[model samples]
Target: MNKTLIVATLALTLGTTAADAKTRLLVNCFWPSSHFACSEVLPAWIDEVERVTEGRVTGIIPPKSVAPPPDQVAAVQKGIADVSVMFNGFFGESVTGPLVAMQPFVGSNSAEAMSRALWRTNREFFADEIDTVQLLSQFVISPAELYSQTDTPMNSIEDLAGRKMWVLPGPLAEIAKKLGSGVVSSPAVSSNEIISRGVVDGHLGLDPQAVQAFQLMPYTKSTTAFSTPIYSTSFSVFANSDKWAELSPEDQEAIMSVSGEALAAAFGARWDKAAAAAVAAYPEAGIEVVEADPAFEAALTEAAAFVTEGWLKAAADAGMDGQGVLDFYTSQLAQ
Candidate 1:
């Protein structure tokens, strides 16, 4: 073969190899495409990943294709998808300790603090607690506060008590009970059907965008919070262990770089921003705003103790040092 023929062949081979070397990952998440968690965070994450990978990795997220957000983890675990985002709270009856995010006053307003602690805990504690699959990172939801309709103000435990209140199952209701409020397990209902029907007076949730997405806040008249927030929600990004193993070392490292605490904080900030936007919309939306009365706040803290006890017990059952996990989480936040 002549020099020209050899050079031509080499160029073609190199071009093909460059393109083939690119790694492609399909990510699945439960949030609707419009939701910031999905639209902003995930899309921004893909961009960051691509930029950091220097074109060696690319991602695809079929916005609406992932189905119910609650089932995202199952889809990934079943190999229906390669990666997914899931909530420990959503795991339902199984009782994974990290879902403790559902309990009030357990988290702070700093997403970075919560994320790093959660990531660390996953390696040391959650690893044994959750054996179903692999965890990339854990993140906290924005904030959990009380949002009520205009007719009534949640001024004190007495104001909240004797009133029909909406609470998510698992850990959140300990506060409502302490406040002497009737617990109603229907956030979805409050977000849609129940609020419109006047079944409950208030809803507890964070991520202002979440309320907007569900359109539940439109019916709410007021929100009660410390401004710094009492607690935050938590969730994680994950991959199917089997599929994760199939990737090359370079690919794994590239993905891992995007995991851990930093990502958690970044995700957390987005929630804060979203929540702030929702809070600002209160007056325009005909929603009222009130500080949680001291009595009610005190009662809330007292009731939350039970949730901690329950979590510690559950963690012990799962072979973890609940106090250690709690200490790590709380200490990391202070740092």
Candidate 2:
């Protein structure tokens, strides 16, 4: 063959190779499509991924979640979905590093700050805690406040003890149980069913945005805010290890440029904004909001001591300095 003919053939082969090298990720969102995470956060991150990688890497959210919230990490591990978010609470002892952020009365109300701090702390310590998937980023939602549908606000441990409460599974549930509150523990997605059905007289595991998103506003008569968050849920944005490994080193680096702390900041900012809107609408919705008196706050602090102790023990068992890690996370929040 002539030189021109040989060159033309090589060009076509290279073009086909480039096309075959492109990757398309199947992203799953457990929340409703109308939710900010599905509608905005994931999509925005996908856009950045594509842009940074020059269209070599792209992702799309499926019409529905591939698995329930608690099973998200497993689904990704089994390759049922290429990427998804998992709530840290669902894994129990399987995931301990993130529990630092979930400790009662520890985190700030600002999801952005808390999220960034969690990511940084995770990277520096306990990085091996989650080895099943490629951990991409981390975030914490706004801190949960006490919301009651009962005759009176839950201002003290006695008030809380008097009512059966629905709480987000994990630390919050444990805290309520310790406080002598009759507890029904489940994922936040189930909050509507339990609250609307009056399965519990109060709830203790949702930020204002979640309260609004889960449609619990109608069922909640009063909200008692503490000096610090009663509790917060931590989450991990992760990808299937196999799928992540398939990407070229250059593309992987490109994607990382827009992930980690950048992604956490984006997700946290959305939570903060949505929560603010929800809180501002409280008056119009007729949901009475009251700040917890110092006595009430002190009572809760005393009751929640065990949660912190348990976490510190777990961290030590995992060969981590639990108190040091916790101190680092809280110090980052103050900054």
Best by TM-score: 2
Question: TM-score of the candidate numbered 2?
Answer: 0.95
In model 1, what are the clashing residue pairs, if there are any? 30-69, 141-233, 148-221, 149-221, 150-221, 221-287, 221-288, 222-288
**lDDT (C-alpha, whole model) for all candidates:** 0.71, 0.89
lDDT digits (tens) for residues 1-335 of candidate 1: 99999999999999999767866678886766666776788777778778777777777887575657678778888888777887767776564667655455777766656777777766666665555766777888766667776577776667767678777655666666666787777544245776667788777654456677678766877777663466677887887888778766776787678766667777887877876787678778887767777777776677567777877888788777878888877777777
Candidate 1 colliding pairs, count: 8
Q: Each model's TM-score? A: 0.86, 0.95
What tens-digit string does per-residue lDDT give for candidate 2 at 267-329?
Answer: 899999999999998998789988898998998898888989989998899888999999999
Give the CA lDDT, 0 to 100, for residue 247 in model 2. 93
Compute the lDDT of residue 265 as modeled in candidate 1. 72
* The best candidate in terms of lDDT: 2
Candidate 2 backbone clash number: 0
Which residue pairs show collisions in model 2?
Answer: none
